[model samples]
Target: MNKPEKIVAEDLSEAVTYPPEAFISREYAEAEPDKLWSKVWQQAGRVEELKAVGDYITYNICHDSILIVRDTPETLKAYHNVCTHRGRRLVGNNTGGGPKTVAQDKGAHSARGSQMKFGCNYHAWTFDLAGDAIYIPDKEDWQGALDNVCTSLTPVQVDTWGGWIWINMDLDAGPLREWLEPVASLIDPFEFEKMRYRFRYWGIFDCNWKVALEAFLEPYHVQGTHPQLIKYGDFYSFSKAFGFHGQTGFDSKAHRDAGTAVETSVHRAAGDGDPRTTIAQMQAEYWETIGASTSETLVKTAQRLPLELPEGTPAGEVHQYWMKIAKEADAARGVTWPDLSDAQVAAAGLALSIFPNVNFIPGPTFSLAYRVRPWGTDPDKCIFEAVALDRFGEGEEPETEWTFVEQDLDKWPYVIAQDISNMVEMQRGYKSRGFKGNLPNPWQERKVTNLHRGLAHFMGTGHLKRID
Candidate 1:
């Protein structure tokens, strides 16, 4: 893959102005279903979730509910979740087996087999996997009423790419692969389909969907939002746009500098002792303060680094050693690490923003993926879902469920919690009378600008002109 050319903030000649009301207006939120959400292909669920012929999952976006089902060993289908008879929802649970009835229920009968079918709880209207109306009561009541009506469940366009099931409500919408564009090609080598979800979390935030989505698109917030990370790497980032999407790459110079500076400081403070010995002692104290031992990866990586290095050893030597340790660790876990270039390995932790609603923090062995969507019609509240995926050897995939985190927000991982801490307050600030439109840092926030520009294009707003 080609590395993205870094562009400085001052060199960007165009500025995409975003109005403040876009983040807080109910009318704008209401218009999204038709203008944006309906027209775009959105990820419905992971392909692994519906492996069996009868397995199915329901994905709800705003007021739209879609039922995605695995109809055969190789065929998957998606349909509107509403029963045609009375518009009642066909599936109430997030995921479950096909329609069946227990013998103990008063009005229930058994259609108990592996072939999944959807039975509306309201009137027991049954639809086959293909979404054809299979059974309905009182068939003679209105004999001609069903003659001209297309009673079968309405199917939305469905496709799969990168092991994800994507659905678009607009039947005329472009193909999924075409919509994904450069992002699809950029990440194709990672073999994301081989990864399984380690955990899935959902939280309701008092902020716009864009506000929540934008939080992960850039690393500039690291210095203020996550000060602890500064010691590990530089907060300065390089960003590049790909029309509808963009990515941010971090420079690790500060981390290398810190290693050497710490060594010198420790040597000076400890008098004539070997500098390596002094540095080792300092590392022990620092790790204790940060509680690094509690994290298995941190502990393993720390153990591999020499506690005492030669006085003139370059920090690159330490980084090379850590990479060696990482490879060994993966080998022990039965994982075959991908063949990646030096630049690709360096950018393993880069954050990428896919236009509309998805963002990813890609890693060599694991990745953190996020999806943000408006919750119902409320402009101030949105649903934020996070999924952590890890590469596992064959037959070792984890069995996980969507765990809602809003009830106990404190349970979220530290970095994620820190990012979330700023969201609610930021949303409140947007409603303040004194605030004006957003003023994004041209280079650091270019991804945010690219995202809004995509939104404008989809919403029929004027095209954002880029001044050469």
Candidate 2:
């Protein structure tokens, strides 16, 4: 049989010709920061990360440092990280308590329930967790008068779903679910509430975040950039689309059936603890849904399928939630265990991308969550971060091993060191003067074009004007 044609779909020549400056320009980055960051909602962090009554986390959105705090068991409130009194950053680091002592003053009860206030580190001006000003230290000494009304921490908009918190910089923006309505149900089933945070790694790519994001939205690069991935899996045509807050795309098919015989067990790494029983139960339940198989078969199947949802459908983060469940299922059964025989009842990944920034790719054994923040318009210099949650079975964590077709590190970054190497260089090349955009073969370029369209929509530029 003739070899399948390689899809060299992206027209790199044309893409590069659009002045690189357009993407990396500082002016572009600074323009409409609020409109870009606030007008749309962004993922803040997992809700459990801020479990305590006073627990809080800091987030950097469009250069603004935001402090998000839990005011009630189910309620999360956000505020400007700046202290109203001295303009100094209020909360520092990821998350923390106000201080050793939380002083109580005024009509607020210091009994330590919900009325606790936030005190400035500099002058000790106090504000409630609700971002309301409670007291000014030495009120009589200052002027016997202090404005409690204006001293409250500036409040920002926030909401929660799938046990994760989302904040909107634009207080004027409508409800988050209103925006997420288009893609929520599509991703909610993976039971994210149960998935453990297996590990987290970061890479600083010289390339723009958009480039980094674009890298994972489609499998077109599997044959070239990821030669090993190509070796292990077959690339199906790509399909993608955009919705209110994000985008969704995936490979056409990997031709593997769930009942295949590629089962291989995960290695037992020292210090890797046993799996969790709850997770194992969840995994078993998942296997009952999707059937058991090796990671290779599972991934290939995942790649070939479109999200089992219709285009432009709204679901409450169905993919990530479902992913947490699926990962637990895979971990419970073991990466390569064949105990999963109910082929009729397996739950696999249903990856989706939320426009402009997030790409939610939930695999059976793991999931890849990415955010594509624009560095510039050139689309090459943006900052991209890929966080992989490698979920293992319920009881103990095993020393996980990565498997790919070729041993080349660059092509398969699943191992960490390799992913960073390519990201850095790709960022540098965004500034290459010899640049020109390249042509994208129709079959492989679906995700790229879909994203371009999404960007153009948000930029409010006419579709024809897209620099693609």
Candidate 3:
């Protein structure tokens, strides 16, 4: 709608001293890894990860690699990923797990799965799929009380939503949904269950984790960090605030509406090369040229006559077709399209950066979701794993996995690459002598400040006492 005036340094100094750069330091990240990660909630994996019984995925959070297993369609569990005997990491392979008796094929499009048991690969310390230690290796090692004394793997508190499984390390912590209150409402309208996961692409950035996250929170940097996005994209105003558990940021309604329009420059290009006229003609040519979509409806409605098809057109089909046309228009003009499948887009292009270290991006037809785990208690360097979800009918599976594909590089390459890099650099910068202090841009960087404030509040630090 309107440009946000940059606040002068004098004005910023009186607001918040937590500079934008404070989020980019290694020392800051390492100082309270446990304090930051353990007390708050962390995302584990998606429900689709353990799609079948005994289907399990191992996740390594800060200082902990957990083994998550779906023992049955209804019963799911998470365990510490360490071996019971030799203490080696259990379930080293990505696809390693238990039997498939835990799930069932009730009907097409139905969410059902099952698993029987789990075992450590190091010394074969076996446990039920529910994390109960069932069997030990030795028979007469110490005494006759082995079976009575030995137990299953340690369990973590978990919660599920939109097909995702979230875990909290705090045993006495509040409920998962309570903590998610900050972002759940911001993203709940997408109804992510209907969409699927496409492939995820990740790169370590040159900045701190917060820097990478802050880059995504606002559209303010779209003019510079991603110049190409400004072509069909908007970067005028932003909505920023502190949610119950996380921070919230979004573009203005004008920006959202502006992005739907095709650029006038592209409209003029229609008749130049192929003798076509108007924006629609240019888009049609471009779509056909690149084998993309050019549905008349997806073109900015203000630019052309609205097409009214026969009543026989299915409502869902109409929307899909129009979306395809819009995507084709974007591709023809070199617009940065969300790298997701049709399923993800239908689900919603909206994403959720759940405070500490989880981001759930629901695309139009598919979704790109991931959880960042601290690397050996270092919050800067994280172990990132993304799950791409898509729904196939009964007896159907994707021929090739698309969740691991890296397709959004053109639009946000620098941001993704800069994330891990900044994490390490900031880790080092926290100890810098030249680092006087940080002064955050209140209007633009409110979410970053909100995040810092949340962390401080959760950890019982009085530094962010301004909120109180």
Writing each residue's lDDT as its tens digit, candidate 3 over 1-468 gives: 111233323212235544333354445555555666666667665666676778876655444556677777787777776666667655553211111232332211112234476566667777777666677767467577555334556667777876677776677889987877746654455455544444444433333455445544544555655454344334444334436233323334443422211211112211122121233343454333321122232345213322533334443344444455656654565433445543323222223467766655443334445554444434444344445544333334343232232323443334343333334555567557787555555665555556666655455442332210
Compute the lDDT of residue 143 as modeled in candidate 2. 71
Please rank every candidate by lDDT, starting with the best. Answer: 1, 2, 3
Clashes of each: 0, 89, 57
Q: After superposition, how far is residue 83 of candidate 1 from its true place, in Å?
A: 0.8
Judged by TM-score, which candidate is best? Answer: 1
**Candidate 3 or 1, higher lDDT:** 1
Lowest-lDDT window of 10 residues in candidate 1?
A: 261-270
Query: Alpha carbon lDDT of residue 107, candidate 3?
Result: 18
TM-score, ranked from best to worst: 1, 3, 2
Candidate 2 lDDT, 28-109, residue by residue in tens: 4555364466577777666667767787767654446677888878788888778887786665431111111333221110
lDDT of 1 by residue, 1-468 (tens): 112133323334355455665688787888888788888889888898888898887777777778888899998898888999998777653221112234332211101123478888889889899888888888678776784247799989999877888999999988888988777776666677777788788877788888889888887797898886555434576565776878766534343322221222111112234333333443454334422212234245545455534455545454445455666777787876666544443433366767788986654555678898887767888888888777776777778877767724477776777788889888998999888557666767788777866776676552344433
Tell me the whole-model lDDT of each prediction, alpha carbons only.
Answer: 0.66, 0.48, 0.48
